[model samples]
Target chain A: MAPTEASERPSLERLLATREIMVACGPGGVGKTTTAAAAGVMAAVKHGGKVLVLTVDPARRLATALGLTGIGNKEHRVPDEAFAEAGLKSRGELWVAMLDTKQSWDDLIARHAPDEATRDEILANPLYQNISGRFIQSHDYIAMERLYEIHSEGRYDLIVVDTPPTRNALDFLDAPERMADFFSSRLLRWLIMPYRSRLVNVATKPFYQIADRILGTEFLGDISEFFILFQTMYDGFVERSRAVGRLLADRRTTFLVVSTLESVPLREAEFFAQELTSRHLHLGAMVMNKVLPEYLRGSEAADAAHTMAEQAGELGGLLSERMGPAHEPLRDSAQVTRVLKEISASFLNFQTVALREAEERDELSVAPEVMVSVPFFDTEIHDLGGLYRLGEQIWE
Target chain B: MNDLLDKKLLFVTGKGGVGKTSVATSLAFLAASRGQRVLLCEVDGKGDVAGLLESPPTAFKEREVSPGLFAMTMDTEEAMKEYLRLNLRVPFAGRIGPVAKAFDFLASAAPGVREILVVGKLCYEVREAHYDLVVVDATASGHIVGLLAAPQAVNSLVKVGLIRNQTDWMLEMLTDPAQTGLVAVCTPEEMPVTETIELAGRVRNETTVNLASVVVNRVLPELFGTQEEEVFETLTRPDVAAELELLVGSDTAPVLEAARLAVTLRRTRSVHLDRLREAIDPSVPLLYLPYLFTRSHGLRTTRQTATSLGEELGY
Candidate 1:
């Protein structure tokens, strides 16, 4: 849910000191990767412990923001040069990597399988192949294993992860419980049993016999083989998804949800935050990033220019009431500045309404801190230097 | 005079989080100042075009941002939804919620080229010469080729009215160099520039549109003033020390230690810009937008930014 009052909320700082797994999640282009890394870098530099920043999608922006060439599964030390030019002295530093989902799955199987034979058996299966090897975007639970791996590595003080932007942003957050629920469901259990029983007894398997007769094909053989292979991995995947649900719910694990001060995205943010609560994940903060602060118009010189700006815009009267106090109109430029204040106010009001709706979510929420990251400079956080600048704003 | 300008449309695309918006805005500013009636269009669903415009974001049916400058942020879902409702004349818009959701889901989630229809529609807008100049912010790199290749991707998928006609016309427009120019945006960093150049190659192979230009946004101009040692020495001096108190922000450092930061900040940012220049094409003109003291660039600042472009490009 959206945060109702900052007074009532605890905040990210309070949660960060306590929580282990702090997820900075939202939809694409909302600065998820950079925020996670900046916070990771900032937390490390501030608290004197290494912080890991893991990105999912392979975009250059992530690499440049960390001031690195290319990032992969291996956690590389963020070179001193990366933030050196930003002119800040750092204490501890960020350890960065990108999620190699397919490789991660292979590694998980290699580590967890009962034996190499069972591992081989599972990997050979097509269903396993589909989910593990070819799942276009890996499931949340699958990604969680990667998160858990980084968390357990203990090299970093905290693991700041940028989760893959799921087509449905909330789907990644909600999928684990749903996947586990599907696995634990009785109907699925029944469907799998018959499929498993067929693998052991070909003669008595009615569905197999019926399938071969109707299709004149060996589809059931392939299907049974697929299930048999998946049967070994199914319990583990379900168990892992369940543990993720538990880990995400831990009081110390904070979810700092980020969004713009816009209605639709904030609405999505509120819905996603509520989904976390419904699923029992700990809420840390609802951070409204890129907020537009009020611009008040006052000076006599500015007043005359403001009046002129109002004359030009359709919403000038509203500007006169609210956001104004614009730049001193340069000599001979009074006419051009006309109604500019009103246009600025209209945009500011849109932001105000968006932030207010976000504040309303605090009434039903659990996050201790309801913070907003106000809009400021920089078109894109292109490099680590940009992130270094972005990090300063977190404190200021 | 506006009608006399070259009408070549520029389409900018890069991987997500690349400086696509800035580059597209700069290119539009570049064209507009050149006296083209530039209409910068964003179909990325971000309303980024409006964000770049001096005007506030609204319904986005082409509002004027400046003289000879108009901009619009296309809501793909809204545009496509309206298109479907009006053109296809779906019996009931509400009843087709499931179908609409399914179409969007399948379009986004279905593995291949479900994007052609929407892209085909966008292509139609550009093809129609609705504006003398059209600059599109295409989807991120991963889905863009398949998105651009939607027409060929849909030859067998279906045979329909506007979808078919739009797709065919879009293919023609995109393939015509004189009519279209595709520019990939990148930063000076290795990955953005590398992927940008790589994508340029891909564009040439996949389509015949002119690879107009690649604009690298936010490159630092290396300053050539004080040496590192003198900067360090200047930090230690007493009078200069007290003077630094008001600005050098930190918990650990006192006023005296603040000078230590200036050298690093000044030296490093310049090196980055030099690296960016080395990585990008030397011939492609570089437009430097000075780091603004404020973050959310106001209308005034955006105009300043555009004016800086005008001066640099001599538009």
Candidate 2:
């Protein structure tokens, strides 16, 4: 059989069209959020698919980029005029949602609680309130739940997710399972066993007194009460968390590892790539964002620098003379020459960075994964117009 | 800079990739250069500081990486072990399996317990008379707030305990302006600047952590003044492009492109820097770290940046 058309387009573009869920994950400060937004916009405008971009713990940037009032838990449609101005039209629609971890936690408890009284009790527990509200680990789990909840609704053809800049990005992959494990761990059961069976408590009284001396009697009582209440909903938490984990492992879902070609981020990207493989998650693409443009590579940069320096005096004289004698003070020979020399030096400096970036990209591209290179723009992308420019390059 | 030196602890944080590790290490280097005994602790298991120092990776144990400068990556488990060994003074605090598991459960169950252990360890060092300065390379954004606010969170949750007393000691050191200060790092970009502003506000309102200074990293210098920008605007004309052939001997394309990028970057960067200046508190100092154009962003560049930072701080 002849080669299919899907094999012709770049691997990343094909994945964008085919995959139902695309997760953009990377080390911090690699423009992962913008890349995810741009990809969603691209899929919506080009592939004729309804898309929803989800961002967890964003720095309040996705809203400004999508031209929305705010990026809360609610999904909002990005105005079509913004796309129209960029000379693009979305055949379907584009939606944006930011994960509100607290709301998600409350919703999860409400869904799992056996009764309203139990839900109220869990919500009011000081330990429960602290962990669900303040812990970043809970956000990772809730974000997955929210993703699965929205994906299961089948309201959108594509869902793009931007994860938090975690020190260990793989934590998101394992958080659901870990949360379930913690809930069902023998340690937790043992800690709460006394409350469940009064007979077991009598046997472990010596252990409880020892613990009470270490962690005060009141603290122990508070923890035992908290776990006793939590035990009622233990099966529900484990089952739902496992469902989220299964959703992540679904064939339709894939992860896009994003990073710059800098040494540090490249190392992180490799770690993510390896971790994803080990976890058996589908690798959609590796987006190498902010790869410096290779303006002058190898010996050319040095040759160009030397030639520019040699011609600096002549260029300075001509430009000053062209400006006329009236502006003589403004065209000081020393200053003009300084600017000329500095420009060449700056070019050489940037070329070196670009060259190093290219080498790093080469190292990452050796893997079987699809690598998409995005040139660093001079300006930070913060709006639809910026996203349009970025979207154009993401597909390139 | 001397003002910063007087601080018992300096917590350096920024949006990721804004060079917090390098900034924290450079600050440690500068402090050590000024004859201070400095302990540079990397929190959250981020061991990149050791790599940047061109030294072996620092484990849980502190090692003197440079003259009068020590380094270690804070390990929560190890910190707990140390806390138990030192506080309880039990012979088998680490070896006793049952007791260790109990402490593990206690540490794991609480929300901010790990953070408190890390912050508490930093405070423990600050209190020791041996070290004059301790620099904590904290995680970025919300995590930094979480780390700094750990003491208060634990304090409010546990009304009375050895944990309360430990965190209270940490809180005392952290809340004192002379004892602890925070250096907010950011680049001249929209997200980083906006995040820095939000972080500064949070640090001010939520905790007594002194917002010592804002270090704007990789700032493009003003290569073009108003007159030069006006002059260059004319240069973009087609007429000038043709005249440029006579000005420079053979090729003008490379020079033109580089000059164009310089102008655009300078103008673009200034916009965000202006926003940062307006958003940050005027009383808090703002320092700039110029873009280091070195071939390798390794130790040499870090040392050069440290020198510039030290100079800017008047060390």
Candidate 3:
């Protein structure tokens, strides 16, 4: 490797070329999923290897373009024809998969259960059904668990995982540990002991009595039954979760914190980056998406906008007189004035936001090694071509 | 159509960073300014509601942040304690520390336990007639259906628990259009719009709550009409642009380019806005809030949002 390459500032391209895993996460509505897909695309295009993007949910068009629609928990390759259609060629293969939480949970249960009967019983359990399908927090654990499963398979050279939109952004990071602790906790044993032995001790009688009344004895019994069945797979679950934790903290894994320049998402992203650093996880790059253009921040633009807004009528008159004979539309001074005023006012308005974005960028406390900004695209990024366009902006 | 503020409870939710807190705070402000006693609850406990209101951080205990306006942050453990005291008549003073911890663990394991507590507390405020209106800054779009459907989930699972009995009335209040409604907030962007549309469908089919309205925040101003747009195009032509630069005594390209960017942005957003309108039920009103170009967010932004919300509500 060249010395210049070694000393160069870290970029997403370099990060992707080096790391085996990139976890894209931050606040919702900040293009985390799309950015992850773009990064995966860039990796496949620039580096010759198999790259897979594991996204929780994608827009319908993007899903269709990636052939991800109705294909849950299965990785699919993006066809060469699709790349041709997008006017691009990839050096390596690009793959996509959507996280199917319930399917992942069922697979986990099947893998860990002591016997087929126990696996079927747990799958049939109503509480298990609800926990697997309806529980929101279950998503946090299952996503990471699925990633661990896929990574262990060694099918893809690079895996870009888009995390679920969690209530707290850090939930998935703590999920493996929490899952391990949940099965090992003494409370689980205490809560299920009576059901297991059919005896409530004198010291524990009051607690069970209160619980029985509040939860109803039958519900308590059901809960105990569920936990009792779950307890059978405790060892496997704990060991698997610990392995998942190690995988996240591994040197080959890196995190890409994605956010917009807006204050709220930026704050959340900053906090997420700080937490990743404190946890000794690699914060490889920060991708700021949908950022306003730099031209909006130039003093020359502000000066021009100020003058235009203040002297709109005079400028409109001067321009209309000079150009009205050639262009019929400019003949109307009033319309021209309105246009100039609207243009200047719009510029100033966006300038205010642009300047605020600069401040927010400056105020970001946690600095990752590489920070890249994706300029706002006028149209939605819904296909490979659009993704390629976005990928190119941050590739360097 | 029913007036929005006339409803006893309103849950405002959206994808994060789309100004969910602002809409919730503004709705509370609008209701309070109209002399209604409004209790605003933040379910995520982010303290964003308090920050938007320019009030001190709120706890599970409601505090009057303004005249007729009360604010609180949801703590599921505190709610469980209150439920135990009020319904079960459990002695919560002595053993609650440990008992609540144990219940917290159970809640974490149980699918709907934590969600039920949140919905239960909000319903309790309504059932007690403590406030004329209760506005919840609820969970994001992804988790909201689970939260709102918790009662039905608990009801089907628990059969005969105290929670089962509690969910009946809560479901009654939630399903009733006169008493409760959900406002889905979104920006005029691709993901937010898609999520909002998907959320509306889920809230209708999965949960008992009514989709009362969809608030589209950050609708960028349309910079030109057809005739004026032609004029703008003329102004941007190199020859005309150069003359305008000389007339303005500065480079006018950036200013014109900014306008072009703004126009394209608004045009692109209008497509999503149209899709949102077409996807959502026609009966549900779509309220548009203009993008704020303010330097900072605080009470001022909240008040401006409230004013816009008022105008949209035809106040």
Best DockQ goes to which candidate? Answer: 3
Q: What is the DockQ of candidate 2?
A: 0.46
Show where candidate 2 strays beyond 4 Å.
Answer: A1-7, A59-61, A195-214, A298-302, A318-332, A365-368, B93-98, B229-250
Report the CA-based lDDT of candidate 3 relative to the real structure: 0.91
lDDT of 2 by residue, B1-315 (tens): 458778889999999888888899998988888898999988855568877788888988999998998999988777877776787666765354455555566666666877888888888987876599999888777678888888888787777768767777788889998889999999998789989999998998877688998998988767666655555555455666456555554455565576688778888888989999998889788888998766666667768888988878886
Count: clashes, candidate 1: 23
Please give me the DockQ of candidate 3 compared with the native complex: 0.86
- Looking at chain B only, the TM-scores across the models are 0.69, 0.93, 0.98
Across residues B25-115, which tens digit of lDDT does each residue of candidate 1 receive?
Answer: 7667667766777777766555555655656773547777877777776655555565566555667767445444434433332222235
Pairs that clash in candidate 3: none
TM-score of each: 0.54, 0.93, 0.98
lDDT (tens digit, per residue) of candidate 3 on A320-349: 999999989999999999999999999999
Which pairs of residues collide in candidate 2?
none
DockQ of each: 0.04, 0.46, 0.86
- Please, what are the lDDT tens digits per residue for candidate 2 over residues A189-288? 7678754473356545544645554456676677878888888889988988898899888889888988898887788888888888877888878888
Q: What TM-score applies to chain A of candidate 1? A: 0.75
